[model samples]
Every structure is written in C-alpha cells, then in structure tokens.
Target: MRLRSCLAALALVLLGGAAHAAEECPAKSTSMDDIIAVLNAAPGCDRAMKLFEACEYGASGDVQFGEIVEKKCEADFLGHLKPPQKLSYQRELRVCDRKYRNKSGTIYISFTAFCRAEVAQRYSRRALKAGGAGR
Candidate 1:
C-alpha cells in the first residue's frame, strides 16, 4: 500500500516533468558536463532529462551523454536523501541494475543509468514538492 502510493507520486512527477522536458530539451552535445549542468538546474532534471533519455537510445556518441548524465544525476539524487532513504534507494538501484546487467559495454550501463535517473528525478520532484511532508 505504501509502495503503491509512492509509485503513484513518482508517476505524477514524471508526467509533469515530461511536458517541461519536451519544451526545454537541448541540442545534441558532446560535452557531458554541459548536459549535467543543465540537468542540475532542474530540481527533477526535467528540462535536460530528455537529453539523457534520448541519448540513451542513441548510438556511439550519444551513449556518452547518457553515461555522464546518469552518474551525476544518481549522485545528485542520493545527495538529497537521508541515511535510511539512501539505504532503501541503494536496494532499489540494485534492482534497477539487475534489469539491465546482462547487456555488454556502455549500452547496459547507460540503460541502467537511465532507469536510476528516472527514478531519482521522480523522487526529487515529489520530495521537494511536499517539502518533505508525509514521507
């Protein structure tokens, strides 16, 4: 029951972010920091999260963007959580990693990164929105 409500909250955040993402997605870039910088500006990385999402699906150079975004996004997301939340997130992230652990090279890494970043962003938006209330 609690998990279901959390999932619902996550969905609301992602759906809200998607609309903003569409309008604010940046041009393709070679610099990972460039993308991360933009992502950092968004509480949920909503604007630049699209870039990471699209880049994950891209071949070659695009995968680099996803790799960079995911690492920083994951770190950024975890930075905002408490000790207990971090432990729970690590467990959740392990599940996320397992879902893509089979693929070789950057593809699997980037895919799992995307999955983690997506969840991180959702938590960020919802947590910030509620001012840490009712958690």
Candidate 2:
C-alpha cells in the first residue's frame, strides 16, 4: 500500500525529466517487458515493491539490495543512451527526484521502479520498430 502511493507520487515528480525522455524517445505500441528486475530474480513488481518498502522503512535488511538495484537501473538506462545524450539523460534522471522533492522513503523507492518500467518499455518499443529506433 505504502509503496503503491509512493510510486504514484514518484511518477508525478519524475514526469518532469521523464517527460524529456518521453519526448526524446517516446514509447510505441509493442510488447512491453518490465525492466525493474535489476535483481534478476525479483519475481515481479509486487514482490519488488515489497522489498523496496521493507528496505526503505528498515523492516528488513534490504538496504544493500535496494542500492544494488538502483545502481543497476542507472547502468542499464545509461546503456540505452548514445554518448551525446547520456549526459542529458543522467541530468534528467537526477533532476527528476530533486525537482519534485518528496519526503517519503516509499516515494523514492517507487520512483525507481516507475522509471525502470518506463525505461524498459521505451527500449522494448524501440526494438520493435523497423530499425531499432522509435517511430
């Protein structure tokens, strides 16, 4: 429940920079794959959200797990960007959370998941296009 709300808030905040990403590489109609599984064996988003919420609120010793997922997300997202665009995307990624400025720990964690889903879907759609570039 908490993670769900946090994710919603995170999306509104992330919309600012993610909006740029959307403008740069909009998602297309295609088979979407979830990419927030930096954990590889994360099962699904519901479990992942539970992990994030537990990690954030200290209900479990999952802080290290969350950090690893976060780093992986950044790394994976960076892989999709061209050299010239990388800097701008990174800036947008960083600026997203800061601009919205939410105090809830759940918000931050859910934002990570939301952004991951967007990035994954964007890349998936791009791959589905004629030449691996979004239409």
Candidate 3:
C-alpha cells in the first residue's frame, strides 16, 4: 500500500526525465527498444526487472500501472508530431489511459507523451546516478 504509493511517486519523478529523453530519442519503432534499454540500464539488472514488472503491471488486475501510462504518453506525443515538418521551438506532451488482457491476466495502463523537443541530455548525469537511464 504505502510502499506501492511511494514507488509510484518515485516512478512519476523518474518518468519526468525519461519522458524528455524519449523526446530526444523520438522513439520510432526501433527506438522503443532503445527507450526500454535505457530504462533497463538505469538500475542494475535485478532492480530494473523489479521496476519494470511493477511499472508494466500492478498487483491488482483492475489498476493501471506506470508502464502503460508512459507508453500512452509517448504515443500521444508522436501522433501530434506526425509529418515531422510541423516541429517548432515549443513542445508539449499528452497522455492517455488504456487497458489490455491476456490469458494470464488483465492489464490497465496509461501510455502517451508528446513534445517538440527533448530534455534527455539535461538530466543525463542525474539519471545515470539515480538509475533512470539504466546505466
């Protein structure tokens, strides 16, 4: 309960920078793997696995998780940036919620982010130390 809440907060905080990083990387198919890789590198393998699992899915089948939120945010951002020729100095992000299911379980998450630019480089050092970049 409390721990999960705290972890969620931590994830949100960590996500701030990651969202920006994704903007810089502009996750085009191949970049999705890179984004996940960066997240995997942020922490050691074991911790990364735990975080990844938690973010990907929560304890309950009814609740949305961090991973879904992030993915939706990223997608929203890309949709807005479509055609790529409309890019400008300003940037923005939009997030949405979604749900999915498998034979094993039901999943809920928010997956979206939008922006005209990226700030991944700005927090590169801190992210490395905080284990956000997976390094």
Candidate 4:
C-alpha cells in the first residue's frame, strides 16, 4: 500500500513539472520581426546561426550533397532556433521546410550570411527586390 501511494505521488509530481514546463514555453509569435527579435534575444543565436550556415553549405547542391546533409541542416537550424525545452523540434522543422521550399539560391545565400553585416547589406537589397525580405 505504501509503495503504491509513493508511485502515485511521484507520477503526480512528474506530470505537474511537465505542465509547468509547457506553460513556460513561449508561444510562437506572428511576423518576421517578432521571430527575429525572439531569436536575437536567445543566448546561442550566433553559435546556432553559425552551425546552420555550415550545415547549409554542406547541404547545398554545390557540395557533395545528399539528403543526410539537408536533414542535418534542418535539424541543426531547428535546434538552434528554439531549444528542445522550449519547442518541438520536429514540428518546427516541418513548418520551416514548408516555408522555405520554393526559396531562391540568392535568398538561401542571404540566410547563410545572416550573422555578417556586410553580406547582409549586399544581399538585403537583392532579397528585398526578390520579395525574400518579408511578406
């Protein structure tokens, strides 16, 4: 009887903790500006962006390309965008893939250099014209 009660108490504690964690996760905000703001505010944005860029290059057609590289890039980007504690990585990756499916090479290049000022300055102009900046 004592063991049964202990197990039930432990289960309740675990469920309560999960509920608290879910409440702490930020709701997905609308708009690119808001999304960017959230990303910029995060601690590992720069590192995550760098990892994403490196993985992206490996995944590109110009490299020794394969689905594996692409998958790695997608996973890394989603992982960095919102850590596991805050977001569902698989769900986020699916949404990201859908949004980026028809993007041009130039826009892809812009994202690859998102952390660099000069590259962004050069590409932002073209991206603006291509309707890649924001909708």
- Candidate No. with top lDDT: 1
Per-prediction TM-score: 0.53, 0.34, 0.19, 0.26
- The TM-score that candidate 2 achieves is 0.34
Better of 2 and 4 by TM-score: 2
Model 2 lDDT tens row, 1-135: 999999999999898776555321112221122222333454433343333443333322233444444453444344566777667555655664464356566556545544543443343344345244322
RMSD of 2: 14.0
Instruction: Write out the backbone clash pairs for model 1.
Output: none
Model 2, runs deviating above 4 Å? 1-80, 120-124, 127-135
Stretches of model 3 off by over 4 angstroms after superposition: 1-63, 83-135
lDDT of 3 by residue, 55-134 (tens): 33233421222343334223323333435422421232221221123224332221221110122122233335444443
In candidate 1, where is summed lDDT lowest over 10 consecutive residues?
54-63
Candidate 1's TM-score reads 0.53
lDDT of model 2, residue 91: 60
TM-score-best of 3 and 4: 4
The lDDT per prediction is: 0.61, 0.45, 0.35, 0.39
Q: How many residue pairs clash in each candidate?
A: 0, 0, 20, 0
Specify the highest-TM-score model's number.
Answer: 1
RMSD values, in order shown: 9.8, 14.0, 18.1, 17.7
Instruction: State in Å the error of residue 2, model 1.
Output: 43
1 or 3, which is superior by lDDT?
Answer: 1
